[model samples]
Target: MQIGNWKSTPELGPLYRQIREMGLERNIAELDAFGFTVLEPGVAAPMEWVRRLRDRLLDVAHERTGVPHDLEGGAHGQLNTQPHFKHQYILYYLLLEDPIFQQAVCNPHLLALQTYMLGFNCRLSSCTSFVKWRDEEGYGPTLGLHADTPVAHPIPVGKDTHTGNSAFLLTDYTLANGALAMVPGSHRHARQPGRGEGVDAAIPIEAPMGSLVVWNGNMWHGAFPRSEEGLRLVLTMYFNRAYLYPQEDYRRNVTQAILDANPKRLAVLLGLADANMWDSADGPDFRGAFDVLRAAQEEAGLPTTANPYEAQPDETDVQVAAG
Candidate 1:
């Protein structure tokens, strides 16, 4: 089948105009108010774009990380067996360099949703290229059912607001292939017991390839174990209100050229720009981290943020206590 030009398609033109005009903050707010939203296929990107990304990602994963391109088996079976899979899976930042991936991240609809949930002055917290091999369930028991919020840390004062995560499926998200299961509205609940029943109901986010799913970080969600035979791949990106630490060190990962080219608003999302200062008891200004990054990006050629799959600092880095 011929791949249509998604960017030029009439079906997507309206959304494009909406995103261009609404601004990221307003768009994100709209999505947050609604709980979850999905951008229909061909609106943001064409299926071919996803296919190309998946192909490039597989190459990078194998060349840089040495993960087999065609590994068959569950993530569980690969556990402890493959050294690469032992740690968090491999990630490629260059993926974000792709126009398609950039569009996916800056997609006005998705950004608007994230901004609304996270509050104004939000930025991309992290971006990852994930390939869940067939039957090779090795990436830690499908994520436990929980909101994306930092479970251990209290929310930060002044900056306390809703945050969210979005995943762009590069392949079909089938129930048999470990699709993400989420509890709608669970983000509102404060303390959900581990391995308990009735915390919230799990709903599978099944969708065709190229579809995007954005949800509140507070919403309880996790990946289901795969029972089928094909790679379940996705490129996940997160946007959080300013004043929160990014999942990856954006100052170190993104290219300076990209940073120089980005609008100040987009630069802020990349953590190459700073938001207003807020007094806090949490040691340093806490929010100054982005300033540190912005300066570094200016001095250095570019920043190289780590992949989400990479090892993270402890809970302290991920949590923001509520005031």
Candidate 2:
């Protein structure tokens, strides 16, 4: 790991302490001991939901790549072997086409993990994928080990890494599969891996479909080549503090109906609070989102000071209903 300028504590307030009291000490210990932790498939994601997300991704990938690829094909025909390729279609955002992605961002365990690691004000950075097809030997270049951010979002080197990626495996991961490789406790190194360095120490992760792996964004990690026949598909939803910019402008993709339905974690994940986009002037019939958001926030036990975005008097008629 390349040494860096890392702080000893991240900027988190009262809400941070509250999250500690939520009794996540065991999981926190796992994160401290290892750069990442895996949740058993049944506990993290149900098979029904897993199949839905996998089918959705494959449908979109097939349409765009014009390949007759199923979920097993991984990236269809858009696989990019270049390390850190900014234009990699596999990493593109997918929240707009389906509400399943909206639900995914608010996955219960995922939300709880972020609140403890990044505070309740964390927002979704990117909901993307890492895919490797059998034709390519299920191996892609390492993205180069680096913390999710240059400064680790002001999180201390030992306590928390500020940003996290909760990766859901859409298929099997084994020693022979294109498994993710990681250097345990590398997040505490407070640095980035020099190009092509640290690959030797990485251990292949073996897990089954529907299982999820949550990791500190700073972990020294990358992909390992597969000697197996099938592809490896992983859906990753990355998050960081609300003040940090999100990779995707999620608000634009969230529908008004979704806001009105008020999934407890949606507003924060969608970045509505950061943008001050909490209301509608479309009158009482349009179903404004602010009141709905307040209800959702209260139910989720998120702090009011952190969100509960207010609208100017004329901007909404929903305030009366909210009160």
Candidate 3:
């Protein structure tokens, strides 16, 4: 999609308008220059808020894996323990289980970055935690340096990279902790990197805790081996252009209570609503999504108008929080 502004409708509500404009121009510049950018700690949320999110995720990791854990020792988790997962343990559908998760994924600045990179009608394809355990028994740190989108739509010979991700560090991302390693500007590489080329040439991303690292999914990137003594946790929300189907049906996973309680701006991100999503909108029973949007008005009961996934401009003072 061309880099431009998307208009907002009443159904988008006031919050969407504000997020639509947050740090837009600067973020676009960063994305164009390097295919990624790092928003400082607290840009997406307060330090205390993110700290709590980390604790909750760790709690879930231990419970789910039956692994004894402590911050000092880190928790044990991997594909063997989680048979259906890859890399580290994946905690899916966290959006419905906890309020803090909802707050993290729908963070205003994060939303703005997603819009600027993936387009206005972007779909939050995945909300998962890639937990790197330090000293987990038999755990290996190395992973392939690869692109998330190369499988579905191989990067055209001369096209800009597509698909993107927002990885919020609950703990600091540093070389000592197996931070994400990448070759700057590698997203524009002619094609996928040879196995050893990308991995050998990559550099670790060292940023403070709470930093939100945004990157094109096609970038040559992977995690560094964990050498630290604690957990290296990051919550990543991967986004795709509006047209592509999400890996998990976010719409079906959430409950009526969550829908009624959440802000309307998240309705689209959560797949509770979308302006142009017609994959399931063929019949009069525009499915449960349309009905959810209709019922997603402000608490005062004003009729929600228009379900367009587009965003509009504003002057909300998008702060990067100075990493």
Candidate 4:
């Protein structure tokens, strides 16, 4: 009798409820069942904004590498350097390159899904681009689909998602356009696939421009060879739990102006709220920790007052060495 009486009804968390409000319950269900989900155009952001992102990505690519890519024929043909594969260009650290990229990460629907997959305190690991063109050699799948999180086998189950990945389609994604190939339900495997393993089950994720495709970090995924005659543009945003190290040093490198321009949530996503990393002479900043708590409360629709440490510390003086 006591056991039956004490079991309280299960309820969705505030973040989960937020996701439902944004009409992403199905997307959440897909992630839970299939390890991946695609949010259609206009769901994540406006088509006009997506188009602007595409244009800016191309501009950054040209400015960084001095390559006026032939957009029609897919003749960009690799950046004359070895990337993880051929006929593709990997643009790293796009967040610092432009304000549009900053806006891209703060998208409400996108962030809601990101929070749902990772956690309320998840930190952005990286913001980059994948500019791919047709491969003359007829691109083959990588040796095997790979997991984004580098962890030991039998990756922990449940909500402790160590990492998560989202790819924003700047151009139409189709099997013919070398879209992402993912193994359905592979996240439950909790282990990386061996070479040539899981290939038979992999399917290309097709979505229109402006769509956002997200997946569990433990899922096995790779891209198909581009057969079409135009560029397949993508802006990828990677995320990790607060404890794990981020791919980009946003905490140390994020400028004050950038933080000022965006919402308070941006500071939280950039790892400014994480108080664990303390190399300062004055020791840990408790203010950031409170900021994090305030943010969580606000997102939960709880009443909260402005934080005393509303102005984040100036990190412009901090210098990080390049690889």
Number of the top TM-score candidate: 4
TM-score of 1: 0.65
Report lDDT (CA) for all predictions.
0.58, 0.67, 0.66, 0.79
RMSD of each: 12.0, 8.3, 9.6, 6.6
The count of residue-pair clashes in candidate 1 stands at 37
Which candidate has the highest lDDT of all?
Answer: 4
Q: Would you list the rank order by lDDT, best first? A: 4, 2, 3, 1
Candidate 2 lDDT score relative to the true structure: 0.67
Which segments of model 4 are wrong by more than 4 Å?
1-12, 77-84, 136-144, 158-160, 292-323
Ranking by TM-score: 4, 2, 3, 1
TM-score against native, each model: 0.65, 0.75, 0.75, 0.85
Give lDDT tens digits, candidate 4, residues 186-217: 88887778887788899989999999999999
Over the stretch 142-192, how does candidate 2's per-residue lDDT look in tens digits? Answer: 534456754633346455665788888888888667677888887877667
At residue 269, candidate 2 shows an lDDT of: 72
Cα distance off (Å), candidate 2, residue 290? 9.0
Model 4 alpha-carbon miss at residue 120, Å:
0.9
